[model samples]
Target: MEVHAIVDDLAEQLSKSGERWLHASAAKPKYFEFTPVELFAVTERMSLAEPTHELSADISHLVEFLHCVKNLKIRGARGYIGSSNVVWNALPFSLHLCKNILALWFTDCDVKMVSGLVNIRKTAKRIVVHYSMKNIEDLLLESSSIDDPNLLERWQRVEEVDFSFNDIDSIHPSIVLLKTMQRLNLSHNKIVNIGDQLQHLAFLTELDLSHNAIVHIDEWHTKLGNIKTLNLAGNKIANTHGLRRLFSLQTLDLSDNAISDIESASAVGKLPVLEKYDLRGNNVLNTIEYRTRVFEGFGERFTEIELDGRKADDREKDTVAVRLALQKAKKEREDLARLRKLQIDERIRFLSGEEHVARSV
Candidate 1:
């Protein structure tokens, strides 16, 4: 059942029993206040009152009510009761009451209301704070420094984090402190550089930086060596030179970028394990022999890579194969012609040796 229905039923029972605290005619408390014990007492009396339909027997409703009450957090002057937002953001309750929470999300929640998250840093595994803060540094660090003792326990065991759709321009230094982070989404932000901030996250695998302002990724080889999936689509990247050392990367998204030269983009083909890449909306796609040249760069492993959301069909692969063979044949013919010219020159020199020697003398 919905949390509001449960609260309404509980409130109705309280009002019928002459509980004037929440009654319309009786004076309401200046501030909203309720405890698990008080709720339990009311539930016990309510269950006793309904002897025909025992509240204890309806474990689902009781469990639902308890779940809602557990999230009733007090934030400055206002608080939330069940699904109703009394106003403000902060921990729904005390730290002890929130010890078991596994996932926490704060969408458009003001900065002042999120100060309470420090209390449950050790408990939450998957945390999402979207469209909330402008600078991530202010949220995770003090004076832009991650060396504080108090910030050490924050995000200790978090495996996944989504700080997308914010006004973040640069990566926060404290983000590297998430030692156990595996997947991170920083897409739809204003990030410009793939800085060394994430170099130490050895456990991170998947990273989404799509739709950002990243123009150049010059030093990514050292930093993003462990990532398997990397999304750089809809950015201003011109080439894949920075991703040459991503030996572990299997999937790469470079779509909607400014890659104009096929040779410059061929840099990603050097990656040992790169299996999929998206180069759509790039200037290189308009060049003649674009796919063939790009496939040629992969050098015998072109068939293994997926380009532009599809694998090379048999016809396209045959075309690349024929082009490669023709190029090899052309090189061999050029080498043979050069050798023949040298042989003919030697014969001519042999024939003119005496004449040439006499003229020199």
Candidate 2:
């Protein structure tokens, strides 16, 4: 029988048993293809959740098929909770259900609901939470309690956490609890300082604090020697002097800030390994000569610079300057061509006059 048929048979058996089904049929087989360890990982994780009469019947059938299935993937679980308007207060139980989740992406979800999901701290490898500021304070407060030796052991496994587009103002003291975090994205928030609370995230490789109210990136206590991607775009930062300390940075985005002149742009251009620079929508368009000068100063260090997305007035000035330059060059070329043609005609007339004189003689 085909894999779908097999999955359908398994799903029917599971439905009859009334257990929470992973519905892995939606995920690609390659992602879920299992090795011996991976198979054991899934089974071990499933054992942690409380088995209901309904869940038990479903799980029994799924366990039988688990032997044939090489991979197990779960997808499209959006708002799986209907608006029964009943608050089940199932935080601990749901957290236990997510024990083996390797990746968790929560976008536009209510923050209050997410606080409950954090209970499965030991098993999740990566977690991305975006556009949820309402519950950030509560989430941070709860996560900070993981300082217990046993809790710290579980928290250390998380590799990446993206909390962008939230209205977070202050860096929570609890964020310091994540010791093994490799990538942290806090872009598009209202944060101002790079306080000492960040020093605890020792293994961070990619840090994005872009589009915030950040005035400076210097207050960060952690040595960013291992950081590779740093995006500080759309902030209130006026200078680039503080960024020179990030030696391992490869991609740096500082676009749409309150940059006054080319001096600030030049400072960022001088970074050792910076390959792409985005300065669009900034005050760099106040003077094109200075912008060009800064770009020239960078020489061949940068591959591309974003300059076209300036305000309408700046764009008009750039367009006028380009048109004026082209007009001047075109006029000069026309004048030179006319001069050459006049000289050729004079020589032709002289030759014709000489020939006529010789014929008359």
Candidate 3:
């Protein structure tokens, strides 16, 4: 049976009993709080309350039994139990009580941030800080913004964090502290560089830093061994020097950059196992014989390559095959003609008796 169904069954049994039961919070000094592992504690966790002067008949004791709720979504609620205007950001509850909660969505609340996040450090897997002003945005994920009380402790199981379109200038170093994080989207922000701040996330696979002000190529972060799909589109990257060590990269996007020369563009060919490469909007792609030279340059190792967002179609692929075949045949024919001329010269030397003297000498 579901948890709520079990709670309903337990509540009915509590009602039939002659004994009076009160919420652990209301009883306080008179009645003792039972341990969560106890059998009676599970029944008492339900909203079944014997009549009490402190609480109404049907009031749900959040602090006493909220541990039962796995996915807790606190939406539009002004404040926590004892939250006042003076300290509106602080949620009034023992973090240990809700340690069993799996996910918490604190949305549309008065404040964007809250204190005591370190309390539920164990079971809180996903924490979404969403406050929409007609839409959601993280004004900036600066060091002071994300560095809170035991943030790394609370964000242990968090795998995805979306802090986009908030004019964030820099990636807070604490983001790299999330050892379990896999995907991070900082796109459409004001970020110019990533540096070593994001290199420590050992498990991060997909990172989107697109539409940022990453002008200089040196501003990019190296040693991201786990990143597979990187989107650095619409940046000011003029060359691909910093990307030489990203051996794990599969999909690399350098589109719309100023990488406009053959020497700068050829750096992508050294990637040991690159699959899909997007290098559109560069001057080198506009050069004459860009296709034939690039095909010879990259050596057909890249299964799919797109320059200017356009790949060679089937007919063009056939033409390239024919061109390669013809070039190979022409080279073989020249080699055979050279061998024939060498043979004829050797026969002439033998008739002139020069071959015997040369061998003896």
Candidate 4:
């Protein structure tokens, strides 16, 4: 069937519903000529009717139509909410329509209302809310109702959330409910601490707390055990003492912070699982020689380390080469030292004429 024909059929089926439902489905796929209200109702019905259910192939066709008509330009598992007025007003309905949505990207959408968005805690698997209508504080506060029976249960399914560029002071304790979250981006916020609330995120594997005001990373909480990637760039973390507890970490970005010397850099290197590290754009980068020395001291452990991207070349590759050369040179020096000691002992025997002075004597 033609796209428009399919939309028409869906709209006809949807109009049988009430006004609230119709208004919500109005933003349905363009293929259907139904009014926005009709489309909205269809989506509402879809959401409330099914759990653990897959949308029909026809629904996928409708998604495509919505993508074209709404100018969402989305495909595959991604949904784009860029510059769409529908996102701001029909927040709840839009989410209701995307019953099977796995990813949502809302860039530059005016999301002033919190109530409508709360319903989204259930369906979306991955969500990126950048340059949105509400700030982090407002969103966090809105989601703080632990007493809400459905809120916590729904949020647990979310795997990734990016709230970068939002004005947030601290992560609320209520966020612990998102136990399944794997990646969280809180960059460019006004946060100051790796607070006690963080202990709840046991499943978090990647955490981007960069560009914040955090001063320290506390190792007291063992809950960060599963974390593999952590970005503390542009923060006030001056040392690496607190990082020892994140034993499973493989990638760490600490560039552009207050780290002053090779000592702090070496401290990070001691991490057994650390494979990639970023020390670029920090005071440590000021001394080219010290940067080289620290990597050498760490031996052949790191696979890659950021060199501030300042050098007019492939600095990381160069550093790796230098580390290899340093290891070879150290081994050669050890061999030379052993030979010298043997030579010195032989000369002493000769000078004293103690060589086989007769077994008879």
lDDT of each: 0.68, 0.57, 0.56, 0.59
lDDT of 4 by residue, 282-318 (tens): 7877766765656654556544444343321357548
lDDT of 1 by residue, 235-299 (tens): 99998888888889999999999999988789988888899989999999999978878988887
Runs with alpha carbons beyond 4 Å of true place in candidate 3: 1-112, 124-154, 219-223, 280-296, 304-311, 318-361
TM for every model, in the order presented, reads 0.66, 0.58, 0.57, 0.57
lDDT of 4 at 87: 33
Query: Which of the two candidates, 1 or 2, achieves a greater lDDT against the reference?
Result: 1
* Residue 11, model 2, lDDT: 42
Please give the lDDT score at residue 203 for candidate 1.
Answer: 90
Pick the lDDT winner: 1
lDDT of 2 by residue, 1-361 (tens): 1233333344456556322234443353233322222223333445556443444334546554443332233222233224554232211112333334555554444444333344446555576666545434455444445444333333647788878877788776567556678889898788887666565566887888887888776623253546777788888878777776566666777778877787776775555665656666778757666555555545443224433432224554455456556767999999999999999999999999999999999
Candidate 1 TM-score versus the reference: 0.66
Off by over 4 Å in 1: 1-96, 142-151, 326-361
| Candidate 3 vs candidate 4, TM-score winner | 4
- Candidate 4, residue 186: how far the Cα is off, in Å: 0.9
Rank list by lDDT: 1, 4, 2, 3
Q: Local error of candidate 1 at 359, Å?
A: 26
> What lDDT does model 2 reach?
0.57
